[model samples]
Target: MPGPDDVSIRNLTQSPVPYKVLAFYKFADLDDCETLRPELAQFCCGRKIRGTFILAPEGINGTVAGTPDAIDALLDYLYGGAFGTRLAGAEAKVSWSETMPFLRMKVRIKPEIVTLRAPEANPARQVGTYVEPEDWNALIGAGDVTLIDTRNDYEAAIGTFEGAIDPQTKNFTEFKDYVATHLDPAKQKKVAMFCTGGIRCEKASSYLLAQGFEEVFHLKGGILKYLEVTPEAESRFNGECFVFDERVAVTHGLAQGEARLCRACRNPMPSTRACGAIG
Candidate 1:
């Protein structure tokens, strides 16, 4: 079986096909995953769409790519009360490429759409502070703001905002440790945090607040939404944004095909290869 990297490369080499990706959520009100799993699985299976959709009490978070017509058909099905109108305005971001992107489709039920190890997370009660990109640009430059990359170190290495501090963590759990040990006590209220999809920051911001940070802010949709609004040419994010999709990384400002190989594996990474590793 092909690894994730192989699948991404195979897809990328193909001819351009119109495709779109949508990610959204609503406050948890019911057994969302249980309610939506079968229907969503059936929808994706019948259409032969290849990607992953995560359902939880929080809501649904997914990234799927396929032919424009098939994708549109699936969207109509979803919007037509299939997943119910409560998930309305689940707008898809458009991108075209010559790749299959995803090798399979999976719909999983989980406690949270984006896991943060918060066993008692209440999405409805505690949402993170949402900051727009324009505001982020200025805030990042502000001397007082201590910008934190909430994503794993690998993701941040390729592309991140200028002056953003690396947590240097292997994963989110380490992030909490980093915050407790390294984050300056004086920089509490002045800190700004971010993550790949904003989900981590959402939870992390709340955690930070609980840890006594007076003020906290998160990138609204994380890096993806930021790139959508900020334009490709002027982004401070140096390379492709590593997405949980077939593309691996979306070329932010760097040249296409320059940043997708993993340094350790030497396999195709989206941006900077970390440490050269044997494949």
Candidate 2:
């Protein structure tokens, strides 16, 4: 079986695909976001790469799309010369698209890489334990553990781990209130959290810890990593995983699922024909 890196490389070289989307995030103290923005913009523009990259003191988070060679070169520079040291074990979720998804390349500095708007929820200081994808099934399946899906309502509606609590939160900021009322940390001893790419849950788990939750755990790389490794037959996840890109959703093995985003509501629809502008 091909590993995640193998799959990413295969997607890039398999065909004459026009664009490949790379989504990734890293949590580390970065103080030179202002200086880094212009350098990144120049490199990407010179290579004809188009996408948005957000830099912050916390770290970097963004999605970029470009030709196979350009993408590889960009990643090389990011992991090597740009950061001064390697990103260690950073991995990106790679997907293919026929047309360019972004109009232009931009690098902007932000306060937080993934905004939760909770000052107390600091992943830099302390966060939940990292649960590997292989061990995720057993951990969440345990009877005593409380599984919480940290994604937005629409993202959870498409798919999530079986029996996981859907907070039905409209946005990440609402998660603080949802946990305050819906969950009791005293009763829920072991809380397992997960999001699309693990970024949201990083802060969510931290919030839970601040709220006095003793045993807070989060998926190491989120649902994307789980689907990439777990076989369809043995998968614990149900339905398609919603993504923030043109492909919309993906199933087990990272294959594009049968779902499209409604232009009006931005909700996942079974087909374009079903998108009737329903909010």
**TM-score result, candidate 1:** 0.80
lDDT, candidates in the order shown: 0.65, 0.82
Tens digit per residue, CA lDDT, model 1, 153-265 = 77886778888888888768676678768875565557788876666777787777666677778887678767766876667765557776556676642112355655465
Candidate 2 on 30-85: residue-level lDDT in tens? 89888888998999999999989899888888889998888878777677666765
TM per prediction: 0.80, 0.89
Please report the candidate that would top lDDT against the real structure. Answer: 2
RMSD (Å) of each candidate, 1 decimal:
7.1, 3.5
Candidate No. with top TM-score? 2
Residue 129 CA error for candidate 1 (Å)?
Answer: 2.3
